[model samples]
Target: MPKEIKNHICEEETFTGIYSKYSKSLHDFLYYKFGEYLDPNDKMQEAFIKLWENCKKVPPSSARAFLFKVAGNMMLNDIKHRKVVLRYIQTKPKEYTNESPEFIMEEAQFFDKYQKALSKLPEEQRITFLLSKADKKPHKEIAEMLGVTRRVVDSRVYNASLKLKAELEEFNKFYAKKPSKLL
Candidate 1:
């Protein structure tokens, strides 16, 4: 075999060996952290691709870290991109409270207003809110997904809740003043 072809074959074997040793744990860790919004299967593939691409520089001892670092950054970038797209694209709004609406018109209006308010939030804060409130992910998991510290995730969740609460309260006040047409 030619020198380059032989070198490539050896590199492929090393990459496969590294993946066999670490892919499962790496995928599990990523799933726990980013499965809510990120695609675990795709991210796993990307990690392997990055590992192979950087195999020459990444020592075997540090391969795990390299895979995680690459995958984590890819997930974060995906989140940021999705956040930007979601800002312009409309989606079904979440009901903050369990209280039933008196009628269809009132229900529709409530959802519309709630969605508008949610759309106004920054993308990062909105993602933090979704992970905590919508997906019920733990702080550490969210922190890992976003490549941030757990404390940062905690603060983001806290602030998001406060903001949502205030917005809902205001919505309630406005809704209360409207005539009871639905009833």
Candidate 2:
């Protein structure tokens, strides 16, 4: 019988009660949904703060849904922002004064090929591989986030690795026959 619940608006007591009841579940849900890309605890806290801000509009019964909706929206916004930043980084020119022109060109070509190979992979395999490799997430954690079993995550990573390896090997062979100047 928290005062906030009794009042149907967020009071400090009601907010505390609601937070104690739902914060962990909400955090777990966000983590599972977004993986390592987001900070679940921060998002969870933001959602609760939003709830407190709009307590008059949100009833105790609807608070759970409201919090989740807020958190999900926040996560989506963050993802969108991250995409923009990554795109900017990718397109930005690098200035390396010490490296030879040939070396820089070769490095850029290799990265371009690598990106193409990654893009060509099946979506699920690519995502799992990136999560495991780029984000350094463990198999069990990835499985939980993806709502799949650990074995499935394992299989996806293995398959992705094999495919990427093959693609890179082919690229290397194709470039090997060419003169270094051409590469």
Candidate 3:
């Protein structure tokens, strides 16, 4: 018998003997390295299972290293799995818009007019305006996401604002000139 095992136990009582002795230190080690990525309890359980499976061959002196290796490998696998899941989520399609018929028709008319007005503006101005207004993306986040300066985003917003004001004024005049509704 190895000296380490002889000092600890004559014959291994049960896996619980191993767990009660070393679970805390092993849990602390896994938690420190992986943090929120994995449950420390689950990792501890898995580590003990590995130790139990190799109990006959394992000397108590080297048991800690064996448990740590098993848990460390599990953490690495979890990180890789999370990356793949995140990529899949990012690539998923956007949801269809749900709205009443009256709302949808109103939106269609507004969008048709808006699209015509947007077409008259410069490309950069239109993109910034649509992203900021229609998509409601914040200027700073948009700047970072698009790899552009905040000043450029501000400039595009200003040009878009001027063009929209002029176009809306013309639209108001056209609507006002039309005959009043019977209702």
Candidate 4:
């Protein structure tokens, strides 16, 4: 009976006994090696689950090494995955807008107001205006795109531009001369 107890960790009593003896130390080992962010508790519990599933094959004498090795390998895999993601991000070029923070903030604010004013525009007017300004299409091309006469496209775009200029602060000053400022 004593030799069987020494040889097998599959028995319920021996498994629970080993769990109590080693669970805390195993948790501490993982915690110290990987910080709380990586979830040491999860790794520890996973290691124990693997141990439980293989209890019949593993002896009590080798349990500690088995648990630590499994947990360490899992942690290493997670770290390697993080490194791959970081490498991907590093390979991407950063957007290099030379504008100052204040300029960028003011531009955002203007964009918000412009979006609001544009949304308030009548649908046909908004569509025509966008085709003209955003697509840089001429009035004749915008008319062709909208399946409307050139005069209709011209009126819609003109009315939409007037409403935008009125609703947006500093828009006329900045936009009138090729947008030298507030781009």
Best by TM-score: 2
Better of 1 and 4 by lDDT: 4
Give the total clashing residue pairs for model 2: 0
> lDDT per residue, candidate 4, 1-183, as tens digits?
578666678887888888899889988988888878788888988998999999978878889899999998988898999999989988968778777999778777776777788899999999998888877789998888889899999899889889988788678755664342333
TM-score of each model, in listed order = 0.43, 0.47, 0.44, 0.46
In angstroms, the error of model 2 at 178 is: 42
- Maximum-lDDT candidate: 2
Worst lDDT run of 10 residues, candidate 1, spans 174-183
The per-model lDDT (C-alpha) reads 0.75, 0.84, 0.73, 0.83
Task: Judge candidate 3 against the unseen true structure and give its global Cα lDDT, from 0 to 1.
Answer: 0.73
Rank ordering of all candidates by TM-score, starting from the highest = 2, 4, 3, 1
For all the candidates, what are their Cα RMSDs to the real structure?
19.4, 18.1, 13.7, 9.4
lDDT of 3 by residue, 48-119 (tens): 877777787776777778888988888888889999999998896867666678866765575567568888
Order of quality (lDDT): 2, 4, 1, 3
Q: Show the lowest summed lDDT stretch of 10 residues, model 4.
A: 174-183
Give me the runs in candidate 4 sitting further than 4 Å from their true place: 1-7, 93-183
